[model samples]
Target: MSHSIAIIGASGYTGAELIRLLATHPSFEIKALAANSKAGQPLANVFPHLRHLDLPDLVTWEKIDYSQIDLCFCALPHKTSQEVISKLPKSVKIVDLSADFRLRDPAEYEKWYGNAHSAVEMQSEAVYGLTEFYRDEISQARLVAGTGCNAATGQYALRPLVAAGVIDLDEIILDLQCGVSGAGRSLKENLLHAELSEGTNAYAVGSTHRHLGEFDQEFSAIAGRDVKIQFTPHLGPFNRGILATAYVRGDSDAVLAALQSAYEDEPFVEVLPKGETPSTHHVRGSNYCHIGVVQDRLPGRVIVVAALDNLTKGSSGQALQNANLMLGAPETAGLTLAPCFP
Candidate 1:
């Protein structure tokens, strides 16, 4: 029962990652690869590392025969994603790797993204794509929205505790550092080697980061209250992962217990032992999330750390995981590869 697939925005980092992971998938076959700018060019032209695999040449999304695609991965940017997804055929199951559909409220989407959602109807039907927490919903959804890499990392560290009422919600603070690739494959002066390689600095400070909208939406829903965490994101001088450290006022033992209980059964999420800390290097290039819990020097304070590849477990890999469930295949079918460690 192999599922035929199409990847839109194929030249980007997440798009390439989806191709890389799907190349070895037991039940998924790439039927189309679309990258409008690179249309008519071989995938090798944009991604030389992928030259070895026999994949279709890049084509524009409008040229694809969606009738033959079992599922489509929309890896386009935010504002553009909503427009493109709104135009895609309804019969095709879509896993959108954009902020467009992650927030259920059209008003909130506009608040964070600065534009009214053009695909409000589809947005209403789109299930949030955080696999661990929304598995059943995703299995039944026709459209699923992938989460922000920084948001995903922070949630894996705090959602369980918030659900269990073991932490002080209002006092929570999440400080995250993500690799440059998390910004995407697009060009920007700040992302150049000379500007970014030798230094690290925090952007989206003062709780202004867009992912804060996700944190507010998800955490508040779990606690049944307005839960706003102080979030600040730093762009690191590397290429592939996200490390998030959450500061919370909770019993350390209880915090660990909550995380371990929530993810003990999840194949892709690994909760490390007490006092252990996770590193971006440990979970690079794989759909695996490593979490660690440690007691703070002061009692009742705890530090929770989570690490994962921003491109894999954060976006494209998450889209693939949800797609498997929507297609009735095992959730971990194409996602069992081990983390790429140093």
Candidate 2:
């Protein structure tokens, strides 16, 4: 129950979120907070909201000794995590919150990331961190890869259907809208308050977004064949939450039943009754996903909607879930907080 943990890239949005969750975690101690760019600064200076918590000051990654840390949460940028994780001691259990290890295929990782995976051997050892489906594998894993925020949302609305054969996997279409934080804390002209506040638009149209690799891997595996879905993600002006609407050919009642049956015993996923849809605000700031389904106007079609805070259930919170499994702790530990509603 006594586990020492470190967050490798502690200066970003997701890193701060992880710190907030682990602050309430009973079995773990936050031993190190590393941010190469913000070295020597107090975490309060970088993330003022977390100033209330007593935490380690930000330092360079090299200053922390992995020999003393039992688990590490890698919140580094896509290509950066591979480099940093490669150098860590093998004894440290890793829950990588980046795209680096989610794909088992090193060649596919290179294809989407534009660089060959330097830790190809380690990549093969990492387990996909989809907690519900990969529970057994992740519980015994030393290194686990968290899914993309958008990818996780889409799967929430559709994976059960694919596994139960309740929906037409070949015709599934996932249209997702995500909050600004999903884009990260970096400075981008389009993300400025002036430009992003008033409008919402879609990016990564067609099959171009990097998260498609995850959908391809997951959906195909569940159906026991090659199954691909049309996925498009939109950028919303809000600060948190993601709402994914998936259109599939299926019986509305069966889809609802499948979701409820799959997640009723689970802590994070909530499946609403038929005809009731979900809004992102309801699940905002919590490690919960609310899913609902209704009959589509087109005959034999159904619309499944799922909502979650992209930063919570989709990223950091998910990283913590996998870590709990990896550490033999309760899967829902430190993650039972109810959604914050106005």
Candidate 3:
């Protein structure tokens, strides 16, 4: 039997990516779509790239009967998602693609998000949806909070090293580059064609990016101590993908060996052979994460690079992966699409 699913923020890029992936899923059915601003429009109209499929017309959340939805993907913005999800039926499983529930401590959330959490109770129940790290928890979770795209990419590079004690926790630094689409489909002066094309600039520098919260939370838990990493994100002119380069104090062979062993069994996350750096173009439009490890000239340091489609593996693809676990479907179903090439 196909599980009935609803997408609450259908007009956004992540929401549309979900529809693209789930369109061929064997046991999942798209029963409803909600995008208040585009409520009366057809999904095809909102996202022409997905016009080839037969899908439901968009509607306001209030117009849908929640009793019929078995699962829901909440892709709304930060504050709006928590407010909307708090009112959802208790039985509906959720995979949230927002920064709302990723941080467990309300104080920490407020510190980073600059707003008091409106759904503290529901926040406590949301499993951190990093997939590989929390598979068991996600399979049983009523709500799963997706990680930030940059956080996800950086963790793919450093989490295993931190856990295996192969890297020095205190000296970690992540310099990441993200495509403009990660900013969302919303209009911004900087994202304009004449402005964004053929140019790149760094933003959220000096520990200001919110994804640092997720890194601190997950890495600290893995290392059994407080682990803070310096993270800086840059905006590239491309439309999708994230590439994170991490500098760590560690032996090259040990870091490579540890990362290889950690992802040896993971179907989606791949650890490339040593000295082979991965490019974002290779994983674009796919749910795959490619990681590369290399030694730095400095004796005790190594550089780790990780890449993935910010919208796919970083967000929507991950959301679908968690949903597959929650719904008891094959973990790889609807996610076998290969990466696009030039």
Candidate 4:
């Protein structure tokens, strides 16, 4: 009953995370690892922490024998993912960890990513990869699209309230703090330790963050109306988590009730007691998302907070979760590890 798997873009943060989680999976066997740039190198050479486990050496995606792979996780960047996924074999189920397939409207994808989608037809076939809300669809889909980390964090805090009509849709605002790893394994001047260690600053301000497109698409659909939330993201000095605080005009009790009801049965999402806020540290290195609700001193105003590992629940873990459902395995099969907390 073990599912054969392949991982493309296997040298990136999300790619490495998928390997780390799958290493202990009871029903998944890694059959191939693809990293075009590191094609001939052993995975251990690229990620030393994973040296303990024996895994396939990195190869290019074209070199993989997809006929043997039951599921393939594409951790490539946006435009690249579309181009590559379009060329992949149709028989293998795919879980894309890029922004490429998340937006169904090609125009919206072009608007946010500034490039025309290469695979327009496949766009119609991609099921959004927010595991909790899209579980039923994911289980039946051949292609699943992983959500943006920031978008996932915010949605875990707001989607329930939006659906329950317990909050003012037009007045919602989400301010998030994300760790450096969310930027990926790529090198950048700003990510240097000397430059980022002690400070935190907001980037993608004024609702300019690309994840807003996701918020708009998902929230609007839930309400059957346009719902735009002002979102601002900040890059923190840390290396692994995301914490988002949502400000909304609503009855505090109702907001808590909505969130509790929405995730009461979800294995990976936990709703904390009212007045208790979550922290990024609590869910680091795990597939769990923790959410909390707090009442504002002024009545009818509430603050909802959510935290999760940007690389785990936000991307690879989510992809694997969808893959499990698509393959008929227990949804929590390879994802039950506890969060890494110091």
Name the regions of candidate 3 deviating beyond 4 angstroms.
none
* Per-residue alpha-carbon lDDT of candidate 3 for residues 1-342, written as tens digits (9 for 90 to 100): 789999999999999899999998999999999999999998878889999988889999988888999999999999999999998889899999999999999999999999999999988989999999999999999999999999999999999999999888899999999999999989999999999999999998896789999999999999999999888899999999999999999899999999989999999999998999999999999999999988899899899999999999999999999999999999999998999997
For candidate 4, the TM-score is 0.99
Q: Extract clashing residue pairs from model 3.
A: none
* lDDT of every predicted structure (CA atoms): 0.93, 0.91, 0.94, 0.94
Q: Write the per-residue lDDT of candidate 2 for residues 128-210, one digit (tens) a residue.
A: 98788899999999999999999999988888999999998778888999999999999999999999998999998986899
Q: Could you estimate the TM-score for every candidate?
A: 0.99, 0.98, 0.99, 0.99
* Candidate 1 wrongly placed segments (more than 4 Å): none
Model 2: which residue pairs collide?
none
Cα RMSD, each candidate: 0.7, 0.9, 0.8, 0.7
For model 4, the stretches where C-alpha displacement exceeds 4 angstroms are none
Assess the local accuracy of residue 258 in candidate 3 as a C-alpha lDDT between 0 and 100: 94
Highest lDDT, which number?
A: 3
Whose TM-score is higher: candidate 1's or candidate 2's? 1
Stretches of model 2 off by over 4 angstroms after superposition: none
lDDT tens readout by residue for model 1, 205-323: 89568998999999999999999999889999999999999999989999999999999999999999999999999988889999999999999999999999999999989989999
Worst 10 residues of 3 by lDDT: 42-51
